[model samples]
Target: MEFKKFKLIKQMQSTIKKEFIFLLFAAVITSSCRKIFNLPKEKEYLSNNVNFANKILEPVLGRTNLIGGFNGDNSTQPIHFEIVNARYGDGRPVTDIFQKAQTYVWTAAYTGTEKSLAEIEAKRHLEEHPLFEIRSSGEFIMWPSATNDLVTPRPADSTNYPQDTRFFDVKITNTGGERLIRDFQIRPWRERPYDPADDMNLYTGGPAPFPETPYNVLSRNYIRPSRMDNVVGDSTDIDLGNDNYHRNNVLVYIRPFTGGNGHSLRFKVLNKDSVAIDPALFNETEWVRLVHGFNLVKTKEYVQYDVAYPIPLVNLSTIYAPGGSNAYIELKYSRTGFGQQRVTTVLGLNFGIYRAGDWEIVFHFRKDNPRFKDE
Candidate 1:
C-alpha cells in the first residue's frame, strides 16, 4: 500500500506539471496565434494542376443595410445593425434572398495619404453616393430613387477600395462608436447551384477532350475499389478505414470580419427547398448539436465533417442530397471574448433584412426564415 501511495503521488506531480504547461501554452496562444487564412502552408500543397476552393471563392465586394430603418432612439431599441442588399462581383444583385438595399453610400471622400489612379476613381465613385440627402435624419430608403439606382459598385479589380465605410455619422452612436460597418462576402453558387457529389465525382473524358481539361472529379478510393485482405478471388467487400478523410464528409463554408477567434457553430440538415424534412425523411432533432460541439477555429472558415455526418448505406443516396439537388442546413453561431464574457447571440450581424429576430444561417439562395435560434 505504501508503494502504491508513493506511485500515485508521483503520477499526480507529473500530471500537475503537464496541466500547468498546457494552461501556459493555451494562454500565450490565445493572444499571438495567427489565423490560417493564408492557405496551403507548404509549397507542396499548392499545385497549378489542382483547383482549390480558395481560388474559386474569393471574397467579393457587396452592399448591406440595416433591415429596418436605423433607429437611434435608445429608449426605443438597442443599437442594432444588419445587412439588407447583397450583390455579386459581376454586377448581379441578390434580391431573391435578402431583397433590400441601403439607399446611402459613404459621404465625404476617403482621402488616403498616397493614392493610385484606381483608388482615385473608386473614391470618386463612392463620394458621389451619399448616405442620406438630409443631414439631420438619415435612414435607408427601401425604394431607391432612379439617381441612386444608377450608382454602380466599385470595379472588381480596384485594390483596397471599400476597406473603410465610415462616411456618415450615425444618429445614435454607442460608446465604442460602432456603426453598421462590415464586410459582405457573397456566398458561392449565386447563379449556378451544384451538388457536393458533383464536385466530388471524377470527370471522365467528354466534349473538347483532356487537352482542353475538364478535371473537377474527386478520388474514388472511398467507394472501396480494393479487394479484401488479398483473398485472390473473394467476393466479400471491405472498407479500408480512414478516420477523417474530407471527401466522404460534409463541407460548410463560413466568413467573419475578424480572424483567429474561437467560436462554435451548430447546424442541422434539411431538404433542398429550406423546408423541414419529414420524420421518415430526417429528424431535425437527431440533427441537433450534442456534446460534440462543432468548434470554429480561427474564426470563419470552411469546416469538413466525417463520421458526424450521416451516411445511410441502404438507399445509398437517400439521406444526403440527391444527384441534382443541394443539401440545406440551418446554422447557429455563438462566441465568447478572451476573458469568457458572453457576447451578443447575434454578433456583429443582422442578415440586413430581419429586424426582430437574430439570424446567422442566411446562407444558400433560399428566401425562407433561417430559424437559427428556434431549433
Candidate 2:
C-alpha cells in the first residue's frame, strides 16, 4: 500500500510539470507577435497649414510664375495641383523651368471612398458641402504657369477685322480656399493687316493692347427663321408660288447683342425630316453638302466666307431618307468691332431626297434659336 501511494504522487507531479511548460511556450509566442506588429508612425516634413500658405506667397511676393495653389469654391478655376523638381531640403539643384515635374490637382473635399482624380474634379462642381483632404508623397510640388493668353478666339473677318484685345483679372485660391487676383492682358496675334472696306478681314489689323472688359464676361443669342417653309415645283417652274411642289427647307438668322469681336457662333440641328421614300437611294446619296458657302451681306458688296474662319470645321455625317434619323449643324464664327454692330449671314440648304420614282420632303425645327458666345 505505501509503494502504490508513492507511485501515484510521482505521476501527479509529472503531469503538472508538462502543463507549466506548455503555458510558458504560448506566452513567449504571443509577446513576440505583439512587438513585430507595432510599427512607428511616419513623419511629414511640411504641415497642411504651411503648404496652404505657401501657394499664396510665391505668386504675389516672390513674383514666381509657378506657384502651388488650390481652389476653395468649385469655380471655373482648376483645383488640386502638384509641381515637380521644385526646391526642397537644405541644398537641391536650382535648374531652369524644365526641371519642373508634372503636376496634379485634387478636390479640396473628398470621401474615404476610392476614386480617380478626374472623377473628383468633375463631381467637385456638383457636390454640395463636400470635404477635401490633400497630401503630397514627396514626389512633386504643384505650381501655376506664366499668365499668358490662356483663352483666345479666332478673328471673324481676318482680312479687314481690327485686332480684338481684352484685359481680364484671374482669381486664384489656395488649399485653405483663399483667393489671389492677378491682371492678365490678351490681344489678337494678327497675322495680317486690317482694312475696313475688305469684308474678308474685318476684325484683324495687328496685335493691340488689351481693352476694358469684365473678365468673366459671357454672351448669348436667340435666332428666328424669317420663313419656315417654301415649295418648288418641276425643274422648269420658276417660283412654284407655294402650290404644286413642297419646299422642305427653312432659313435661320442670328443677331448678336454684345459688340466685341472674336466670338464663336454654334448651330445644333436637333430634329430632321421624317418623310420616308427609299432606303437604297438614300444610302448612296450625300444628303448634306455645302451647296454655297456661308455669305455675309454688306451694303457695298456681298462677300463669300469659308466656314473655317473662326474655328476649325467640325464635319457632320449626311442624313439618309428612310427619315427617322436626326442630325445637327454647329457653325462657329469670330467677330471684332469697336462698338455694337449687326451683320446678316445666310446658310443655303437642300433638304429633299430624290429617288427615281419617289421623293421625300419634310421640315420642322427640332431645337431652333439656340446660340452661345465664347468669352
Lowest-sum lDDT 10-residue window in model 2: 352-361
The alpha-carbon RMSD values of the candidates against the true structure, listed in the order shown, are 25.7, 22.8
Which residue pairs show backbone clashes in model 1?
Answer: 65-84, 83-352, 84-352
**Residue 129 in candidate 1 has what lDDT?**
30
Candidate number with greatest TM-score: 1
Report lDDT (Cα) of residue 287, candidate 1: 35
Please, what are the lDDT tens digits per residue for candidate 1 over residues 1-375?
999999999999999999999999987675444443433322212112211122111211122222223234332223333343344444445443323334324333532221233343344222233322222233342222111233333232333333311122122333334444323442211111111222221221111112223343332322111111111111212121122133222222122222322222322233336443222221222232221222322212223221111111011222232321222332333334337753222111111111111112212212222222221
Model 2 misplacement above 4 A: 1-163, 174-279, 282-375
Count backbone clashes in candidate 1.
3
Number of clashes found in candidate 2: 31
TM per model?
Answer: 0.20, 0.16
